[model samples]
Target: MTLKNFKVLGILLLLLAVFAVGGKKVSAAVEDRDVQYTIGVVVYNQNSPEMNMFMNYYREYIQQGFPVKFYFSGSINSAEDEINFIRAMKLQGVSGIISFYGQDIQKIVEACDEEEMYYVLGSGSISDEDYDKVKTSPYFLGSVGPDAKADYEAGYNMADYFADADTSSYIVLTGGSSAGNYMHLQRTIGVLEGLAEKEGLTYSEDVEKLASSEKTTVVDAGKDNVSITICPGYMTDPKGINNLKHAFVDRNYDAVLCTFNVDEIMKTITSKEEEQGSNIKVGAVDCFSMENHDEINDNDSFGNPKIDYIAGKYASMGGPAFAILYNAMSGHPEANTDDADSNTVRLYQGFWSASDKDTFNELYGYTQDIYENAYSCADLMKVIKAYSTDTTPDDLKALTEAYTVEDVQKRIEEN
Candidate 1:
């Protein structure tokens, strides 16, 4: 009687174990283990606050479900290095990538095509030529950044504001080695054009032609009743900085127009002011740093500090990048492309000067907060969930439905 009972119990236990294992297998099947996708972010450097923020946002959103890893080149200085790094990263086990450097974009695109992976540019707009090349490729998503020409125009607006005040003859300090040269030149052209329309202004016809030439050169784009001294300051070169500072003193320029790192520019301006007492007005594109405020020598052409007049930046960039990435990954196929020309990305157009602590803090606060939260993987996923179905550039705009610079600004204002 005891043996029979033991045998029956064993059989029942075996059957129960079998059922449990089968149930586990069924659950695993639903979860889809075979599809372990990953995103590889190829950035120039991890140390820069901007890069850190971009990666953080990507990682934050990706960690929720998608596997994301970072592949960064220490501090790439040339196009070749960037290309190699991207090529190597493509070989890694990643389904997609978001590349940051501009110099090696073509190479990166080619590599991505070879690897059969999806990609997008995180910052810096692409050229029409590049756009034409990737127009039909599924592997090439699109770029998420301000139009370089537009940024230049915004910067030129600062210059125009200064020129209107009769403060002519300026020096321009543009950022990003060769890549940055084009935008800075474009803004310079805009400044020249704006100046030409004003009374007593003279412009050089060579300005447009010079700006467009392969060799980066300085030229007056238009004739104005005023004289504008143009000096080219390379953003990354210390020699270029010193030369620009010297040009400011030598020419007694009315203003200093900068389109790159505000901190570095401030240092150049401060050194000149302290050493030579040059009263050059400082005008620029994008937000100014705290250091710039402490060191500003004069009110901008607009009566506010030049840095304070940054229009539609914080939300324009961070907000859209998050929106686009989300749409792309979540399945809105077209979220990455900016074909609409509607500034769906929030751009802040305001300025800060040393005289107004409130204004300075307000703009800085907004920009910083965006850097902190906007491009995260979660927000990105939200956009993707809504827009991932888009299969064309026209469809991408639909994914930007949830956010606006004003939305981001509102959050900043409330906080």
Candidate 2:
């Protein structure tokens, strides 16, 4: 009896040891498998200041903690280019993609679904038709971008700033004309509306009316003493820039309103000021870098700051997009249950306007500090985890609504 009992006990102990070791090996294999996936980022322009700032925060605060690697496609200018970029990224074996360019949303979403890759929009909105078509795709994770109404409000506010400064005559720079440049068009329309309201001026023709015409430039607004010239084209258009310079030289307008390429136009204005000794005020929309901040705060010969107002995108646009893509890839997708289709579209409002130096300094200073200290890779992962299945679309919206410097600082502090 004693010998048999001892043999049974010895056999049981050996089996338990074998199972324990095998379980550990299986766990190790799963963890190793998690590290094999990759994410591809599609950016319109690699050299853009805003995109550069976004990538810096992405690498520091999001990419580091993730087990996946990152790949960046070259600049995409059109819808066809974006589709081609997605196909290439699929070929490279990316598990998911975050695209900054949102043109041809339906086609892009279809391509991602066909390739079995998760897709998230980094910025920009899709049309209603496109939304209806692709919103239910399992591969379409969703999108985050500047809200259209908020963008229009920013444009209105800036135009109001110029009018309050008593700007009577000005030239407006509208960036791009294609569907991809929809944001620019919204801002341009808002600027015209604001000017017409505050100055009692009226546009003979609107952007839509003028867009179809052969006229690229229009004297669209006029009152007894107030007038505005609108120029619609690409920011990097040499011909357009030259035409703007010629108009400025001839008329010596009171101000210049730029919807994009603020830095380039600022340089042009400074050159004109140096040559003709004219002090022209500027109101622009772009990311606020240290260099731009210095320019905004600098005084001309008459002791007046050259830049009156600036509306900027936050530095960490990539953070929320990464969270969306990561969540979908990790098998917990954020869905919009309120919509009839029960599909998700994560819209983030990201327009911060500062008219005074103190406001700009506070906003910029806190943002820099967060990037350097408070929000790390681990912190970003925690935020992404907050988007678990139990979380609602409102919850996801709250996470991305932290658009201001103060909002971001509070989130970091809470983390």
Candidate 3:
């Protein structure tokens, strides 16, 4: 060959070698990531901002450099569909799943068993029967979220604070049987338990336990003891606010307890006030909006009188979910992964009260923060890395067990 041709040939060979090396490096990185494992997320609906924030954080911090994929079963409506979705994820060779179903968990457990895929429950607690059945599955990781019991504790704590010094009757408002979702039931139960624990309080078991009464002793013997009674109005619909208003107006109650949605509850109370000039003390759970805060502050709807009031709706689920899902994907099996009832399930700090704006800010400041900037995605990623590969059930348990109430409190405080 001529000298010029040989030189051209040599340059072309050099370029080919460089391209070959670069391709191998890229392939190696992809292999290292193991992105082949898809993670299925089954939420009641995909439209909630909270869910979006979580998934965004997961993508940015946990999956950016990783090879994990996410398959979301948006707006799961029925048990059979839920089971089918789990099976579909298994078909996709998903490494695991993170879910929060509105209905039952048995379908989820049974589906996981058939697929042999690792799973973690969030948002919903399992029934006793299902808990027993799924507690031994290696594929079932521990759950983490704000549970029903915590919600009830918060509700009762608010009631105690508002009624502690007053000797007057109060008004209570409920969303009726429709609001008897497991979470609401837990919160209501907690309130009842808290009231029962306090001295001088008795609930009429027959009247749906909506209200209670007690007589307070005055220091002056000449003065009579004041009889405080609580009367509750049940709202099955928004128009039921009229019924609630009538119940409060006709009855001799002092304060109002709203064990339902903050926005709707606030609207009903305000509407009633405008209609009948009522000033009932109100207490509710999960009132996070600024408008809700202003209404509580400006109005007498027995505003959150204590620190842990109105249990911060869904904001408490973010940190624990990041930690748990990471643990599952990293292959570190949690001991309680199999036992849904174990304390290993992380309980994140919720905005327990709305008595003060600053207090509210302390527990949850996300209302003002950007999705990505609000929390540490990298820290979440580290936890996932620990659990992604070569994970054992004991390892999973240890990690979950490490997340105690004290730890969560500290984390909440630090953040």
Candidate 4:
């Protein structure tokens, strides 16, 4: 070939290379970079399956192959202790926080605001008053988890499972239904309302106050000699452990309807169920994991799965929550908060109900604790405004609502 022809070929290749690099630069997203964004995970308990799966999902979602890191705090109670923890996180170069703490959300936000950092609630929600106050703040990125309506339905459905049992005795293992816990309050009320409607009984007592009573109380069966013992407190502390044992020993109820994930707690008394030869049906709001899977598969003396009804969420549901906080820190503070008045991201995530072992096994595909949940790092990146500009808060809501066991199964099959 001639020298002129060879030179022309070289020039053509150089132009193509320039165009390729330019194309890459134009599509740059923050997720492509090696950025470090430290997030704080505020938890009530470090050992519970719910909390463990929750943090596991957040870690796999936000920490894997992204410019993000998570700094978890030990059990935080009052706002004062949490505020102090936030101060400590700031010194570690933490950029933002995702809190599962339920108490004094306003105070937690206030502390974040003071630190000049971004904040997001991993689960549960802020009060209407609290949302109105902090919704406009650039630092406050809104909240998620079941609201009062959802909580009520979750509890109602749990009790409704045993509606036709015709059992005269029932023991309710209420978790945190004590005063100041709105989630448990709504759940307890729903349980009572549902049990009454289906059990052919009438209740005139102030059951609503049972939510905020902060103590265990006996709900009047009202008719047919039914004794509904409302047992509050979990299976952890001494008082709570004693309460659990006493409820089983004293009430000898035929069924247990719990508002929280009581799979482990219930396992504590399987021997008692055997000794009494009780065919107790169990329902709880729990998580989608093998530990729970095993419990759902376990049978009592009557060959019934320890737990038959579960109103639960997948571990990966917490991913979008981190995405919201990351967006705020990315300067797209208005990415969510579709409402003009609230200016806060208010989204609802419903539960995945597994009424039987077959349903749970079909819904939850994992056989072990190495839970590679449905939402992968790539899926989580979709809601990240920095990565996907067109992604809206509405998208997060829809994703959360639709992330069912079937959804997980479909994702696994497709991949």
Candidate 5:
């Protein structure tokens, strides 16, 4: 061969060798991440940004890196729906389940136990009564969620914002508290307690009584007589919607504390604020949806941000939850428990709040798909037992507790 041809051949040979080595490495990586376990994810709604982000973390992010496949059971609310989903997943030979269904956990746990599927509470608490029954079950892995205190504080702080500003008149959306929703009960209490602390109004501490109170039950706040009508259910309840409409039309509420689903009344409140000159403020607990995100930045006719307070959660908050389940399913069950005597775990997560546009926009990237997710495989490796040997439940607990927007931002920046 000519010298020039030989030189070109050598260069081509070197490139071929480099490509071969790179291909082998990529193939090996794919082999290492081959699916070995199927995890069924139970959620109440599939349409919201919260659920979208949540499912994305598992299906797109986690599944891309781990030997896990996620099967989502879209929009299961009741015990029957949960039972049916669990049975179907069992028949599909799913190795485990991550349930977001808070209602009737005991039944769900028992159903999971029957199927011998490892179970975890993806979010929400296991009630004290239910906890006692399933805390020792072999199939019950553990739980991570915003506990009652977190829910209450979400309510309290939101209500406190309006109350501290001397906004006496208010309407409270009880979400599902009347239907025995645990999270709603706590938030409802927080709103009432927060208002009481600010306005010196007396209220029944008994959650059940408050949950069942007749609509338009007036709580006497010394000077203005703060009257709050608890609209029992959320949207889709014709009677509840009627009561809510009545409350809005009949009374001039200065603010509304929506413990769940702010969008339910956002339109009405905004229109009232703009057209009727109603100086109504809003605070609520919900996911970081774009429409609401904009409300945090967009001003109304009165030059005030439409949404004043939002106790929110980013989808990455659910990352460590999968980490916990991963440990349990991967033969490191010891790392899933907290107390030595208890077989189950309870990890509390915090909320990300935004009261103004700057505050909301500052943390906006975290909820969006772009921000290096806090619970990415590398980030979770710090807690995953197989990846980080000697990683304890405490490490996972710390991660769950550090789920606030500020903490997540600090973590992302630090990383």
Candidate 6:
């Protein structure tokens, strides 16, 4: 053989050795791809029961399949805090984020966009103006939350429940300041509208004025025999509990309506009723727990429920939010569809309600069949996988539409 032929064979041999060594590393990287992708979760309060439930479910059921590590932000309150947390996550090699609360959404979106990290809004929503600003941003993976109108409707439903219970005289307690949380404001408006629509009910002109102001107001609903008083204020404030106790518990209102912080109100009313033998029925929104359910469903010594009705509690938004984030990170974003605009916002309806022990058990009792079948990780993963397939927004919406125990039962049976 010629010297040139011998050199050519040596070059080929060198190239073959290189491929053998490099191919193993490349294959190993492909197999471990999920390990490199970290997801940051910006939870409002990591210790909250809702957040606990979400994390527990995600780690136990979802993480095994997805194989991604999660970094949690500590109790974020402000937009600046959230942005700093996001930047820190980005620096730490986080590829995607799911934010449970962001008061300053525009800045958060901008920061995520600058970092080229995917962001999914979980359990909260951005304002229309902020959404419009970030609608076109590739980093904004979209939002998953309860419909804003549903908040108003939740208030309306609570009022209607009270009206149906023959509650002629009652008081209303709001959760937070109107300027701080628009959802609370919308719900407060809904409650007023519902009360105004009830037959044989008349509220003071100041009740109508609640649409403009967040101050607590006493609106008289009934005349002589039936009287209703509506008071609105932030439940988190130190003065809020005192005011609520004075207006509802001390004054012995027949019933109480609370749009936010239902747990605090419920506990206060329960304590007051236990001490004073008051039988004030309670209606509230966003208070769904085993204890809250028992309080609402169990009868007192006199055989009447301490609390009456609750709406919008069983709505677990974290599942959908996680699905959105996972899809975006996996390169199968639901927003990529022709029918879904990149800026499209997904809204889930509130459907859970408990009027009696049977219904309460069916909804909140851990041993119940509905509870047994409630939203498994596999079930949620189905929705996540659908984003890349033929699934439409309507199909996606259907997955979250049935939030009540009965509705969930029917959905499970149908499927």
Top model number, lDDT: 5
Scanning candidate 5 in windows of ten residues, the lowest lDDT window is 23-32
Give per-residue CA lDDT, model 4, range 1-415, as digits (tens): 6574465445434433533654411121245355557666777665667777777665544465467766566656688767766666666566887777847777777777778877777777667888777776767777877778888888888778778666667777777777456787788888888888878667666768655555667776677677788888766667877887876666567777888778557665576677687777778877776578778888877888888788877666777787778777777765666665544687777677878888788666531223345665666667778888898777777765556666766655665
lDDT of each: 0.50, 0.67, 0.50, 0.70, 0.73, 0.64
Which scores higher on lDDT, 3 or 5? Answer: 5
List pairs with backbone clashes in candidate 4. 35-67
Candidates ranked, most accurate by lDDT first: 5, 4, 2, 6, 3, 1
- Once fitted onto the true fold, the runs of candidate 4 whose alpha carbons sit more than 4 angstroms away are 1-35, 210-216, 338-343, 366-374, 403-415
Per residue, candidate 5 scores C-alpha lDDT tens digits across 1-415 of: 7674465456444433543654411122234347677778877776655666577667666777777777676566688777776666666567888877747777877877877888888766776778888887888877888888888888888877887766767888887787767788888888877877887776644545775554645554445566665666766568777777777677677787888867666777876666556678888888666667777778777888888888867667778778888887888877766666765888888687887778777666665554466555777888888888988878877887788666776778778
Model 2: clashing residue pairs? none
Clash-forming residue pairs, model 5? none
Stretches of candidate 5 off by over 4 Å are 1-33, 202-208, 225-227, 301-303, 338-342, 369-371
Number of clashing pairs per prediction, in order: 43, 0, 34, 1, 0, 0
Clashes of 6: 0
> Which candidate model has the greater lDDT, 1 or 4?
4
Minimum summed lDDT over a 10-residue window in model 6 is located at 22-31
Stretches of candidate 6 exceeding 4 Å from the true structure:
1-37, 206-208, 211-214, 248-250, 274-276, 294-303, 334-336, 339-344, 365-372, 386-394, 402-407
Question: 6-52 in candidate 2: lDDT tens per residue?
Answer: 55455434433533654411122124466656777777776676665
TM-score of 4: 0.83
lDDT of 3 by residue, 95-201 (tens): 77777663566667667767777677754465566667666665665466555556667667766766573624444444442334555555555555554555345
